[model samples]
Target: MVDYGQAVDRQADEINPATVDQRARRLLRADEPAAANAPDTHLLQALSLVLTEGASDLHISGGAPPSIRVDGALRPIAGWDRWSPEKVADALGSILTPAQRVEFDKELELDFAYTINGTRFRVNFYQQRNTVGGAFRLIPNEIKSLPELGIPASVARFAHLPRGLVLVTGPTGSGKSTTLAALVDLVNRTRADHIVTVEDPIEFIHDAKKSMISQREVGQDTHSFASALKHVLRQDPDVILIGELRDLETISVALTAAETGHLVFSTLHTQDTAQTIDRIIDVFPPHQQAQVRAQLAATLRGVLCQTLVRKIGGGRVVATEILVTTAAIANLVREGKTHQIASALQSGRTQGMHTMDQHLAELVDAGLITRQAAEEKAMDVEVLKQLVRRIDPTDTSVGDLSNGEIDFNDSFSPGRR
Candidate 1:
């Protein structure tokens, strides 16, 4: 068998570093291995290095030193020599197919997943400051369930619905995709249906259990998410997952798909349930906002806002706020009452709805999280602290009101934060 590593080195050496960016190519050639002797880490080794280092991401720039992201922060590992520009080109040629390379070359940016053994990686390649650098996020072998993640039960319950849209929202590295996987897995085990997912680069690989799954990558199986959704309706799919509602076109297509009877799942980099909805509506122009909101109000099943908080044990856990679109909630959305949804979540506890602040206060009272940390991450710090009821050293029984009084806070706390 032709060794993949040797072949890569030969190919990289063929590419003229002078033609490409110089600094990166120079770094690549520094550790140039002979065609006869190449050092290639097995995909398994790559996965191991990431987990052992507690890295959120691994960077294998074409000609730069490999780096890792720890606790949502990027830090280059010490002592690892930088790869020369030619070496990176060689590695790139080794791992990526021609079509993938062409796509990368055109846009100089890509997001996809890589696999070795049982682990999966979320990969993103892009041109940065003139040099080529990429990030690979390791997807752990164990797919933590919603309960295990301490995400609200209401989110997992979304799996029970036949058709609607469920969104997982938060900043980057906040575990939105992980939560999405947990929900989809729940459906995979319980329901017998076809679930189709379109991602930039596929992440989790779910087996065909009770549900049949078809995963399509952006540049591999199809051109883009919009194209995938465009034809998904005819596939007789019961569940469709759009990796993200990133642009206006994709958002429009997703909403339309959801409206037609498919249970759509997606993610967004937003802070709360209301903001998540607003994000969708605002992505469109003024002329399209009303139509998008109306469609969202009708097809939207739920919204889960999540965050990864550092636990007392020195690891991360997701805390989430779940907003199920009840009749009142839907009415509020249809009527443009986004601000009132938080109040509805608080009062609709029996229906499995919950505001983030309520969950944060509960976490604090249960000793799962510190009160001070909760206040810092809380969207409305003043409101959440009031809900947490930090005894104002002044009064003992009922407690003295802080600035806003001991009434309630209005934000969602996805985790300990």
Candidate 2:
């Protein structure tokens, strides 16, 4: 049989000449049998590659070579053996605890946190085509501030609210967690309060500053988010960070927490501000919708929806739709006229509230991101085109960005084009 390692080495030599010495050194590290049986070796090497390449996510599947997402695209790691099902299982099994292993075996899917060489990773293990596979995203230890992330400065206000529900909504991988963490960290630094975070698998580790912090992982530290929320009020928490408001029970409790005078932060999988409001209200049964709306309108502090777009040169830029609840917005919510929320957002820019399209237009005019990329990420392409045209009415080239071929479902991180 041909040696998979040697074949990878040959491929690497063909593709990247500069890495020949590095490839030779890696090949000399271990014998074939030891390397093949110990999947940990392969996993560790792949993770190390993630660090060196400054990649955001690592992908491992049975039929293909392990790949890493560099910038916003997938680049396969060369000089690595193709993963086999048995090999993948062995590697994953070596890392998962007995309970996690049992859970994976029973459910065929799992999400957990793993640390290697001081770097933390958020891992999702799953079954694909009847075989085990996993995806890993590296979580940076330090949480970036809002300005550092290039988000609007108005977001800091949500952090300072004494009591209310702040929802950071976005598609997966849109930096929602990062933004939420930044907000929580802001509050942590600025206030002397007790903060409790209940996460599925705690991503960023927050050290106690002036504020006391207690982080609980869903499955491991507590039974679930609902369970933790049920008892959190008794813990004397001045601030609560819920990783995600994924269900009605969790959302209900979050609203209760907000109503009871503790600052609460959470996230939802939604695209824009109005849709985020509609989603939370629609989560309840028909009979509860009105009451839910009332509760939300009263307790909702703000909704910040974010999506990452390709910047002009390289890296990603965040286009955010901000909804800072005022009496006008609250009345709109209470009156059940959420359809008009978009109009409110457009006019409320002076109040630090703006739609995603408006933010995209600003980014385009500032030359921070390409008009094409902004159009592709906009909630309303035609609206965005009009916004751009207004900025440069004489420039007829604005319409070129409306190709209608862009897939909005894809999530991206800060990376090269």
Candidate 3:
């Protein structure tokens, strides 16, 4: 049997380039009798590649060479052959515990955390086309601060609030979990209170600093999110972090938790602030919608909607739409006038509230990302163009507002393009 411990301990930089392909071919040989019983050497090498290349995720599936998502794009590793169905299953299955194997066989899917050489990953194994596939998301060992993550300074205020609901909403793989971890870290460093988090397979492990932290994994610590949340209030928590407000029951309980004077942090799969608010309200039955809206207006502190955009040189950066609830915005929520929320965000920049397009323009102006990339991610292209023009009145490449003509070929020169 291969010594998995020694293999995992080897530094990624130590891998000899000349023998990498030979090692990969030998490890992937179909005749290996113990392939199903031990974690494949090739799988460990691919994970090491993820670390060395600064990739966010590793994808293993049948009929494809292992691929890593760097920045925001997927690039298949060179010098590796396409994996067969058996090869994919053997590599991924070797990592699952016997109990997890039973569960996966019963449910056809599984989600859990795995740690190797002190680096943790959030892993999901699923069946597709009668074959197994896996996705491994690398969780950084060190949690970053909000400023370090390029988040706006005003977002730190959410951590200071004694009570209310703050949400970080975005699509999958949009760094929602990382941002939430930063906020929780901030609270842990600055406050003296009890913080309880309910996560499905717990991503970031928190060490209690000034705050006492109790992190519960859904399947391991409790039956489900609803069950954990049902009893969390009785645990005397001052701050609650629901990993993702994924269901109606979870959302309802989170609202109650926030309403009853506990600061709540959660994530939603929504594009922007308006949609996030609407998603919560719409989750309830018609009879409960009005009450939920009122409850949301009263307890909602802020919503931060963010997306990852490819940066100018390499890597990726975040573009965000932040909504800091005010009397006017609260009234709009209560009155069901969410469509008008965008205007409020546009006018509320002094309060640190800005629409997504506005921030996209700022990122383009700062030369952190290109104008074309910003336009692609913008909610309204015309609005983005107008904001870019407003930032630099002398730039004609953004197109004359009088006639809608844009020059996409104009290389983004930061100061005056």
Q: Provide the overall lDDT of each model, using Cα atoms, as 2-decimal numbers.
A: 0.67, 0.78, 0.80
Q: What TM-scores do the predictions have?
A: 0.79, 0.86, 0.87
Q: Which residue pairs in candidate 3 have backbone atoms (N, alpha carbon, C) closer than 3 angstroms, thus clashing? A: none
Using lDDT as the measure, what is the rank order of every candidate, best first?
3, 2, 1
Cα error, candidate 3, residue 343 (Å): 0.4
Tell me the deviation in Å of residue 221 in model 1: 0.9
* Per-residue lDDT of model 1, residues 209-249, tens digit only: 89999998887798877788778888888999999988988
* Candidate 2 TM-score versus the reference: 0.86
**What is the Å distance of residue 215 in model 3 from its true position?**
0.7
Tens digit of per-residue lDDT, candidate 2, span 157-182: 99899999999999878888888888
**How many residue pairs of model 2 clash at the backbone?**
2
lDDT of 3 at 337: 94
**Structure candidate 2, residue pairs in collision:** 71-415, 71-416
lDDT score, candidate 2? 0.78
